[model samples]
Target: MFKWASYFLCSFAVLASKGSWATLQDNNQTVCILKDAPNQCGSFCLSALDPMQTNLDAIERKQGVITSQLWALISRQDVQQKSLPSLDYELRRHTEMQEKHISHLLAVQSEMQALQKEMLHSILDVYKKLNAHQTLVQESLDKSITKEVFENRLEGVDKQLLTIGSTMAILMSRSVDQPHTVQNQSLQSPQASLQESLSEIGSEPPQFEQIGSRHFFIEHNLRLNWTMAAQRCRQIGGHLASFQNRLEFNAVTAKLLTGDVYYWIGMNDLGQEGQFVSVASGNPVAFFDWGYGEPDNLGGNHDCVDIAHAKMWDSKCADEERFICQSDNEV
Candidate 1:
């Protein structure tokens, strides 16, 4: 027999003979019969009717495994519960950003409409003032009978006419880029005056072409980087050109030759990442003509915009290329 087995048997025999701290139980797990009497309680009480030692150890191992699995389940539940709030926050934030962007666009549109109405009212006032000046000049001419008196009156009328003309020019200058606003064609159109003003100032760039209502200086020969190109346009009383719609874009791009050539445009996101605006006016761009997989913002440095074959794409701002300039077109 094993040492432990012999030791256990000796201890049990000693305790049973002493008849101390032992009692009979419901099961047959008897350590020994009562003291000297038969079928009676004993001094030592142990569960001899329990499972074998090997079976007990296996049950213990199984219980440990079950406890570990339960703890694993509890830990996973805790992690998932902790992550739920963060995921919900991100979703709500994205939705709010989208709503704000849409509202801003609507506000800009309404503001533009308000500005147009104000301009029309101002123009009407200027016209009425001009007519009154004309009537005063005619009345002075009819009232003067002598040539010397008429000459003095005519000279005075000429000075007043010059003043009125200057005021009209200033008002007309502000309407160059507002193509959607109402204008009186019978009077002087702003477009004609714009051309005349450009002629008088002698600031029109060489080789500039008129496409639709806007004029563009598509400089295919001069290769310049984005910043340099914008500076060059400023030197010529213009900026890198910006297009407002597909028709204007197509009309201007149709003039370019077919090849791998690209031209710098005014659209850029330098002020804020992912928010493209005109480099000259610093306003959000109104139109987009992106190419396939365009605006990938490759290398995170593609903040400038370029156009080729009528399609736009984002590119590094420092790269040298051809560029277009426009003086009258702010869109």
Candidate 2:
């Protein structure tokens, strides 16, 4: 019996080491309750409990390692939760800043548009004023031109009337002096006799003096302004006398009587100051016969040329003087 107990103890010890002690306890519990098998069965049950206790201790250590890992995971999750509100606040601030920038840009655009509209209005107003001023200037210039034309026409009419009155006065004076002589001469048809009497009493034709290729007529009895002298010359199919050289000037001056009177020549500086030109040919005066600093453009108004004592001098165009006319006999 001692040898069997020793063998059972050794076997139980081997099973406990192998970790199968709980199965052995369930199978041998009824045997351990018998009085005859109490000591050996209790010993066997105690040996089996030892292996179960060791197995329970190893399982508890593995559970403690798993709980520690779960706690670490919970701590990380809490930290992430704590940061969420700060991140949300930063995002909201950025959005508000962007909205304010957009509002400022819109306001600047509106102000620029308003300034541009005001500038356009100011420019339009200036343009209207300039247009009105230009219209007024044009109207004033047109009225001035019309008045000048009317005055010139009236002057021409008055000159013609004066010429006709002078001719009628001369004819009436001749008729009063020779009334019986005019009646005796009208024995033929009244129209033929009247025509003959008119031809006899009319002004005589102008006598011309020939020099070179030109014919000249000196009107010593007529004293007129430069403009009127030129007109009278044109009436006789001639222009104001113009000399080409000193010889022709001397010849013309020799024909005139020496006195205090001056005769108008064709040269004038009316076109431009200091540039004497011939009124007949519209050419610069190549021949200068100025008498001792006489053409100093006296008083800045002496624009006409005159001959005095065979020398040329500048004179006012309004001065009334006798003038000579010349015709191109070659034509």
Candidate 3:
């Protein structure tokens, strides 16, 4: 019995040892590959390495994408930060300059407006004064003349008025381009119309002439003797009728100065010897064209007498002649 048991134990121990050695040998064999067995070991290694390499490559690509995105974000942030102050500064500067310019423009407009107002007021005052003077002069002349003579004088005055009208028209046209002055200028046309209306009312009824312009009725019945005529005219704001050029003389002659009766004229050798002085201007009569031997101081006592009707003699201070006055349309 003891012998059998010992043999059994020994055999069991040997079998156990053999099994352990076989397992170890199998593991070693798997670990140790033959150099020519590349198809087996190489395939195994390549498969594992390929998976690892693919994972690494994917990771690297993800990293590169992330870095590029980050850089783009950073560049955008930098540009915004740099431009913010510059854009803000430019905006502020533009706003400030605009405000200044607006203020300056307002100031200039105010000054120009004030200047225009001043000029308008001044012009209005001058126009009023001129109108008043004309009225007074016209009234005086009306009170001293014969109808025919007054009518004729009115015609002559109308001619002079035409010249003044033309001059005023020219002045207005010249000022048309000045819009700043237009406000006052616009008022003048109506004012002139009023003055003309007043003139029409004050004068005798108008008469249409064939060759020349129309004539207003004369303010006749202001007859005075020779010397008294001039004195009255002066007191009332006029003077005895004065002759200018040959044309004017002819016009007067054609109109009939005082019917057939001799009448006084405004011309006389008052200033320097042989030179005639107009009572109106108190200046030399540069336009005088006397009849033959006129103011030859002919009668020696003819200190003031001149040819009247039909080349006859009339007293210098005689109130027989109609009175006339001179004035400017504009102040």
Candidate 4:
């Protein structure tokens, strides 16, 4: 489009120059024709024709000189016109080159657009694939983490179970060795040995003995619970007896039979928690006996009290055990 506009401008300039040249030539030719015409009348013609004819003749002479100058201008114009085609050819060539360059630019632009579109789609696809890959990897990692936690917990449980089993095995083995161990323990602890000696000897009647102000006698098969046994002793003018001190508890413990057997004494359930009160008054008893945690209502059924001088003070009120009775008088 630009090339055509330039060509039109160049052609218009050339045509205007040619038209001006032609008009100048025609006017100069008419002036020259008059300038060359004979002045046949000469001076007479000049006088009779007035001063205007003389001026007219001088104008013609000037016109002839102008006509010669105009002819020279025309010749130069013609030569310029002959050169214009080459200039036009150069202009057209330049226009063609510009058109080619514009075409190349458009082609490159189209290719860039196409490449940009393809790149955008590829990037989107890659992003989607990356998101999917990350999701799968994260899921796998989560499962692995959960499995590890469960496995660790299971391992800890297995270790704890093993420890418990080992402990149970040791307990069972100790239980299996208990009778022999007890026989050996009889040789070590004086209390255990004395009971052993009593068991070795045949059962005999209690040689009535004084332990403090109270007197006592041992009996065979006087079966009763701790409560009833205390009642029996109370009927004889005293309560079911308590040990005056450790001396009495030890002395009585030495005479009893051993093995799955128990003995009842004069002690009763006082019901005072730490201090045993006398039943006669609610006052605290002057004496008491307890193994560690004794009188603890363990097994939820030990509200009653009894003396097992060899082992502990017990509360198996339902047991039909043998008895040891106490009275105020020497028996």
What is the number of residue pairs that collide in model 4?
A: 2
In angstroms, give how far residue 189 of model 2 lies from its true place: 39
Off by over 4 Å in 4: 1-208, 268-275, 278-283, 329-331
lDDT of 3 by residue, 1-331 (tens): 4334444445554555567767878877433323333343444445545666788799999999999999999999999999999999999999999999999999999999999999999999999999999999888877877679988889999999998788777655433322233233334576444333333322332232332221212224444455554443343334544544565555655544555445455556655556666665676664655556565664443545444453524244433444332221110
Best by lDDT: 1
TM-score for each candidate, following the candidate numbering: 0.40, 0.39, 0.29, 0.32
Clashing residue pairs for model 1: 20-43, 34-40, 34-41
What is the Å distance of residue 186 in model 2 from its true position? 33
- lDDT values for all models: 0.76, 0.74, 0.54, 0.60
Q: In model 3, which regions exceed 4 Å deviation?
A: 1-66, 143-150, 153-331
lDDT of 4 by residue, 1-331 (tens): 4334444444554555567667878877332222211242243333544566567789999999999999999999999999999999999999999999999999999999999999999999999999999999989978778877878989999999999668655543443333232234313344444434333333332345675555776656667666555544443334454565677777776778876677765443445434454443334445566767786766765555555547556465676667676655222
Candidate 3, overall lDDT? Answer: 0.54
Ranking of all predicted structures according to lDDT, beginning with the best and ending with the worst: 1, 2, 4, 3
How far out, in Å, is residue 81 in model 4? Answer: 90
